[model samples]
Target: MELELRHLKTIRTIAEAGSLTKAATALGLAQPALSAQLRRIERALGGALFERGRYGVRATALGELVLERARIVLPAVSELQREAARFARTRRDGLRLRLGGTHGPLLGALVDRLADAVPDTTVTTCTSWSERELAELLAEGRLDFALAGVCGSAAPPDAPQLVWEQIAVDPVFVMLPDGHPLARGREVDLTALADEEWACVPGDGCFGDCFTVACARAGFTPRRMYETDTASCVHLVQVGRAVGLCRATFPPTPGLTTRPLAGTPLVWRHLLGWHPAGQRAETAATVLAQARTAHAGAAARSDSYARWLARRAEPQTAVRRRAGLAS
Candidate 1:
């Protein structure tokens, strides 16, 4: 009754469901109990939140105002609960390293190295979030470290609370169904698929923005037909519905294959972020070295990507050779 998250949830639920009976069913409470709870909450707030009518329940002016705030506060509170759970699990592990980030090949190696380096410390990994969120987790000490990608142009500013090291810069690849016309080769030009609909996560974050910039440089804006994560995006592509951008090191998906972009215009910068106060500063260098090795291993495992790297390195190798001859 003092207006906690439960009270906010109850108010929001009732507003969404449009009646106490439905809200009770959704919240697993009897209608009478739910009605009493609502009354108590209204008493605490000094205002009626709902107007009961023969047709259905509707939010009063006060209810609308309260619901607006609940919408913002509930998600944040839920995120806090999740982060706290992670922090608690880490504590129970006794000297643990918690790492969080987007799914990538480098995580396994990072875990292995951290485990070896710490000896007695348990290493835990969490993925499926954007780099910015991972960085925020590192800042909050919910995570000891994070290996995540950031837009090279709009990367976060340097902060006193966290240290970020640039680990890798890699091009994004186009994932297409095996039967798609463009899937016949190992490389696809960005402009060739200008007419095709894209399946992308609808966000202003790294992936979406990078795709937009890459398409702009290629002289066309991609048509988004589906908005979803990589897993669901793969399904859309598999059904020949849409195409998506993926990392070169992404594990092969059945019925689909990935091709490098012609100029590799879509690029992502991978960074290792850690809060200074969370871990021994000395471990940062070890983590960086491990991450570099992991990235290299990932690249090497992809034959087409390995060939591309070799082709890209040829000029640098020639320069080094010429420098040696001159010396």
Candidate 2:
């Protein structure tokens, strides 16, 4: 009953065509249907909107007033719709990247690489301690990519909507104060720290349980486990209140040292995840390559990891040499 935008559009069409029959054709409606609709529209406005004649149709005084307003309102509404469409397109194709991650150094490294590779891109980041939170954000289209880690051979978060790719795998390491007795060693046995308290940043995965299993395998139950943020964990280790468990790629701290577990009891895998159906999926491969490069750069910067790699390669190199000598 009330005047609506469609009624205004119909009025504008009739005025522009100068006849109901012609307007009906332009609007793809039959003449009778168009005439009926116009009657309803005019009745809703409480007056006749046109004066019909033998030659053609002309506007009455009321029709002229309605047509004048329709001219303004219809064009403005059309322009508004066009501008809205343009704004949507601009946002969709503007090379913006929304990245989410759990706490880690690799996210920052990945951001740095993206900045260098695509100078015009607008990059944003969201950080959380829980990998599930990041995965959910990606599924909800709030984030373009998610960077997180999982324990050795453990499944990534339970987001079937996302595709997870492994960027790198790292051996889990232990952090000790510079003055700790085990800090002098190249590697420390998990059992060697049986009586010491432990501190680790909390995550929404089974990693904590995995650590506990590793300790049990080493023949001792850790005395007291502290779940805290990364900074607090670092402080606990630095002040010798508790040993910290960290990835081998953890950056060096002034008062702390990181060493690999003697037998590599634990491992961490860096993952990059994205919704397979999202617009960002088109660039997923390129972004994944950049992430791998960033991870490699991080590993290269970790002295302990570099030494571990060298030592691991030594055994393989000696085996190759022995086989060649025998041959």
Candidate 3:
């Protein structure tokens, strides 16, 4: 029965709209519902907030006093929320960079770059295999940024409150034991390994479904697909129990060789996400640039990926040349 911020907001809306019907319309409430709510608010305050008139409505003396207080309190509370949001973005010691991500080489590289870029700021990271978990954390304000990947052209997490920016896109590759016959190939055909068991890290995205569709298009179903952690997936590949899927930029592992899938049946798009209303929005551009640089560094260090990039660009370059010749 006590006055609440929502009740205050209703009072203000009624005053601005100048009539109950108009206020109900503005607040998207049925007139009866709004009237009932106003009656409750008036009871809580022990007075009427408005006087009906031929023209519209006017505030009574007590209502005027309440209105004046609402005017002061609402704006002050709004400013308080804004200031608290700014303050909550940092830690007690100073500025802190909180990052959450799914297991990937890019997360480590991004951490390295962020540390170097902001030496005085404390950088912390949490890794979850679930992209949805990271998105939820970012929306809840627990993490300042989220680094995730989605299957080609698939939307990022379902969080509409967060803004997601593309950091890089890479063809998804397959990992094989060094002794495997396909290890020496520049690219392996999707159907070439149809009989091989597959292992992949579990994540919340359309990648699993996309993989199934890709395999179907390749004229075979993947055999015995296993969902496990990243390390376990690599171990499965190392022990030759299953082929592992990974980003093209996966660092070279001692017992395994990673190669792009021919025809690029699958692709990954790296994304950086954060709440746009958060203080981090101000520095999102800087963070995105650093993340891109880190991703480039990782891509550069992978010889196979570098060669793949070069080969992938040749078709575009040739098309441009053909167009120029035609002109």
Candidate 4:
């Protein structure tokens, strides 16, 4: 009978996703359920909102107008919620800083930074469902900061009114058993391992989706034998069960090694986001700096990764040296 914030969020999700199925996936709702909800919203609004098509869905004229209004209303409401959260209660030892991300190395670095900056305050990390969810937690004051790995330079998911900055661009690497044939090489070709069974995290989220897309581009679909987290994936690789995708920042694991994909230039860009309305901007800056420092430290600590960087730089250095000699 009446529209609510949930309805507004659904409208925005549909507009951005461009299809009922996709919007349902993003919102974690079944397709039929999302469609039913959309129908009700449309009925209440007195017109059709989206024009369904074979390829996808597009917003009708009425839908466009509603979305424009939703954008403005949602942020204001979120700001109000954020401000209200600040006044809930004053905690001793100042404010608690909640930091989180899936990157183990980055998380460790951030924890160290927080300890140094706010030794007496509470600091914690968590695994948020996704970047957008992490941003929501920040806006609601449930989370003070978040570190998420996003691929490419595409605009981040719509977490209205939060500040996001790219902290590090980590090169993607392939994890394999140390005794595997490809493990001896400095780098391995994706096509060379087309038939190899892969172990990757489940869900259409960042890690799995990126691995799938990359494999498909290489003219094969990775046979994911095990759907698990980084720890489990590493364990599987150690036993020679399957290979896994990895980032350079991950600490070295015994019986397992990582190599670059020879021709595929895959990467995960680390993003740090904070709630500006929560008045944690200064602290957020410190977190970002600490994360960058952590990334560098992680790379430095990994002998194989450090050597890879050095080998990559040698060609450039040699070219410069030759030029100097010529001059």
Instruction: Give me the displacement of residue 227 in model 4, in angstroms.
Output: 2.6
Lowest lDDT 10-residue stretch of candidate 4 = 86-95
| TM-score of candidate 1 against the unseen true structure | 0.65
Q: Candidate 3 — number of clashing residue pairs? A: 0
Displacement of the residue 81 alpha carbon in candidate 1, Å: 17
Clashing pairs in 3: none
Q: lDDT for model 4, on a 0 to 1 scale?
A: 0.79
Question: lDDT per residue, candidate 3, 129-170, as tens digits?
Answer: 889999988776678888998999998898756899999999
Worst 10 residues of 1 by lDDT: 151-160
Across residues 263-292, which tens digit of lDDT does each residue of candidate 4 receive?
Answer: 645777888887676654566677788878
- Candidate 2 residue-wise lDDT, 175-285, digit = tens: 999999999999999999999999998998889889999999999999999999899999999989999999988997899999999999999999999876664445788
Best by TM-score: 3
Model 3 residue 81 distance off true place after TM-score fit, in angstroms: 7.4
Worst 10 residues of 2 by lDDT: 82-91
The models' CA-based lDDT, in order, is: 0.78, 0.88, 0.89, 0.79
TM-score of 2: 0.71
Candidate 1 residue 288 Cα shift, in angstroms, is: 2.5
Candidate 2: residue 185 lDDT (0-100): 96
Please give the distance, in angstroms, between residue 275's alpha carbon in candidate 4 and its true position after superposition: 1.7
Q: In candidate 1, which residue ranges exceed 4 Å CA deviation?
A: 1-94, 116-119, 157-160, 201-206, 319-327
